[model samples]
Target: MAVAIAVTRERREGETRCAVTPETVKKLIALGATVSVEAGTGLGSSIPDDDYAAAGATVRPDLATVLAGADVLLKVRGPTAAEISALKPGAVVAAMLDAYREKAGVEALKAAGATAFAMEFVPRITRAQVMDVLSSQANLAGYRAVIEAAYAYGKGFPMMMTAAGTVAPAKVFVMGVGVAGLQAIATARRLGAVVTATDVRPATKEQVESLGAKFLAVEDEEFRNAQTAGGYAKPMSAEYQAKQAVLTGEHIRKQDIVITTALIPGRAAPVLVSAEQAASMKPGSVIVDLAVEAGGNVEGSKANEVVTTAGGVQIVGWTNLPGRIAADASALYARNLVAFLGLMIKDGALAVDLDEEILKAAVVTHGGAVVHEGVKG
Candidate 1:
């Protein structure tokens, strides 16, 4: 029997990126999979229905009819309640499920008897680089974070010397030196801002300094080794966090712009900035929290909303930063999906190699069961 893959039309709120593109549709068809797309699914990303049709896909206006016989489902986010109920038992789903963080959504998929793979859970390793959607998406989020902050800042970024007088460069302090933070630092510096960044992980100092930005050091024994084996920032001890918070609070008071990007996988973002810390900022300071979706690093942050602190500082907490650049974001995401797709299917056939490391780490639900240890737990 020929396998059929369907692309979901509905996207999560503020999600402009689609899971797959017509180009990828043609590739899947060449691999012997028939492709069905919901009408207008790719509209936000600037891809029209004619594009999918030209690539040999069937475009159905009704989402239910398109998904009725789908053996595989590709999506930017997890299936919603109505969508899950529409799925056939034993359907295979591949998407950025955000599974560990989305407990209710995972339960729905299980009830619907869908075999699921979460792209976010793909192990961070050289072999899995092509499937690393988090990196691809975070790179965009980081880039957009700087642009958004600069827009809301109400001042120039680069230092300038005019006929009137010399203008000092804006100072940008970035929290969390992961992919998003690093990119924020780079982007801010390109705009001529003096960037200073910090992270719990000691290794990030070099990365911060390598980008021609200063590294804010909260030197202490605990911070010297505050990293997991997977290169993720580890939560610090209470005593260490207290000392670092005091030092960071002092630093926050003097910056023109602050971008916080710290996030721990499967955990809520640590509260890095207290309300007192926010009040300490100058009246016109700006803070952009990239972790607003998973709680927030900044005390006053609210997802997709901006608030003005008592001191008149702007707190930007828009969660889906990458969604603003849907065209490029979707292109990179489709490449990531294709890479993961190659791992599960080869030569136009489904090959479920359960023991394979990549498959083992990413397959959240299979055979009517939650197979991943983390998800199952």
Candidate 2:
């Protein structure tokens, strides 16, 4: 008999992305797993019930039933407390568990006796790239951040010269040129914005300049090499950080729109922009913090809220920006989940080898305990 896999839609407020798509559902069916999905769950992503049916997935009306029978529960976000209670003991759940801050969700998974794998915790290894939810979702988030800033800014993005007047191009400053920051630079440049970006990593300078954006380099002997081999930003020394503060502070005051995307995995977002820097921006300038969910990179940033600073600059800290483009985000996220599950299912049965490198790295809670080294006590 084939293992039963349930791909339920997330019920968390403001979460619109779905973990499984009809295409992935069809693949799971081919691998000898019975696929079940909640009704209307894929609607936000423009995936209809008929699509799932056509892909060999049964659409259940109630979430409780869908979860109760699931041998494996695939989701975008971790299951809510109530939903967790209905899971079959030892059922495997793969999703963005938000293990760092959402303690309640973590506790719920332990109590419900389900093994949880956090897609966000996937190690930055070549073998895990296809299964990386953070990279897949952050790519979309970075692209959307530029679009959001463009929409919010009143002036034109590209330079405009006409018989009447010549309007200078908008200046955009992006902090933390990770996946999101790089995309923002590419998008802003395509939109004709004069882009400048800063990162602690010396390696990112080439990437930023390749996109035609000026890489804001700070003259500091302290930050000769400031990147982890895993492609993550390493915390800078206090001396280097102080120097960067003064330098970037000057650059920021002149930017028309700034987007900050610096975040440390499993930690609170580093405060890149002090309140003083935020207050110095010219009136009507905009700042979008992609790390708003983890305490923000800018001062006074509230998750999911747009607030005007004392200097009249607007700080937008809306979390889950990728969900705003739900259809495509879901499609990509579903593909990521499919790639991960592909490793877990072989020969028409569930084969969870704890020894496997990818599985070992991503599995946060197994056998009803927080087992991942990063998340474990």
Candidate 3:
């Protein structure tokens, strides 16, 4: 018999992405695995049930029906403890397990004898790039951030030379130069904005310039060493932060739009835009906080809410920007999950090998214990 791969509807609020799409359903079936999807799972992504059935998926009416004794469970978010406890012994679960903050969920998976892998924990190495959930999703979030900011702005992105007068292009400043930051620069530039981006890591300077955006920052010694061995930005010293703040704050006053994407895993997002700095911007300017869900990088930013400063600068704290573009986000994310499952499936059966570096980094629970390095005892 073929291995059963069951994809679940996301129960987490504001999650519109699904683990599998019709395109991926066909791929999984071609691999000799039986694919089942929960009813209404793809509706948020604008994929109807008829589409999944046409693509060779069994559409179960309810969660229990779809998940019953499945060899594999795929999800956009981690399953609750109740859902994990219902799985068969040693079942394979892949999702954004968020193991660092959801330590209790890791313990539940261990108790249920389920091998759970957090897609977000996948290594940044070349071989696992296709399976990188963060990159796949952050790319969409970055693009959407610009669109959102443009909508909230008082004027257009591109400068216009009209018969009567000239309308100058909006000034966009993006903080943080990860996958999201790079895409944001590209998008903003394409929209004809004068884009300027800054990051503590010196390497992002070329990346920003490559996208036709100017890089702004103090290239001091601390800025050069601000990147970790894992390729993530290291926490800056207070003295360094103070120096960068003065430079950025003054620049913020002149920017028509600002987007901040800095986030530290398992920690509160560092405040990149202070309250006073936000209030100092031009009255009609706008700011988008992509890290709003992680306690926000901009002061006065609220999750899923838009806050306007007393000076009339709008602060957009819309969480899950990827979900705002659900269809494409789901497609790309589903492809990412398919790429990851390809490594574990062998001869039409479940054959997970934890020794693989990518799997070793992502597996949060196995053999009745919390196993990932990110999880402390």
| Highest lDDT against the true fold, candidate | 3
Sort by TM-score, top down from the best: 3, 2, 1
Q: List residue ranges in candidate 2 displaced over 4 A.
A: none
Q: Candidate 1: global Cα-lDDT?
A: 0.88
Stretches off by above 4 angstroms in model 3 are none
lDDT of 3 by residue, 1-377 (tens): 89899988898899998999999999998877999899999999999999999999999998888889799999988997767866999999999887877878888899998999999999899989999999999999999999999999989999899999999999999999999999999999999999999999888999999999999998899999999887899999999999999999999989999999998887889999999999889998999999998889998999999998788999999888999999999999889999899888888887899998888989988989888766855
Worst 10 residues of 3 by lDDT: 368-377
lDDT of 1 at 247: 85
State the lDDT of candidate 1 residue by residue for 326-361, as single tens digits: 988898898898778777677667776878898788
Model 1 TM-score? 0.97
Q: After aligning candidate 3 to the native by TM-score, how far in Å is the CA of 271 from where it should be?
A: 0.9
| Candidate 3 Cα RMSD after full superposition onto the native fold (Å) | 1.1
Task: Tell me the whole-model lDDT of each prediction, alpha carbons only.
Answer: 0.88, 0.88, 0.92
Evaluation by TM-score, superior candidate among 2 and 3? 3
Q: Once model 3 is optimally superposed onto the true structure by TM-score, how far is the C-alpha of residue 370 displaced, in angstroms?
A: 0.9
Candidate maximizing TM-score? 3
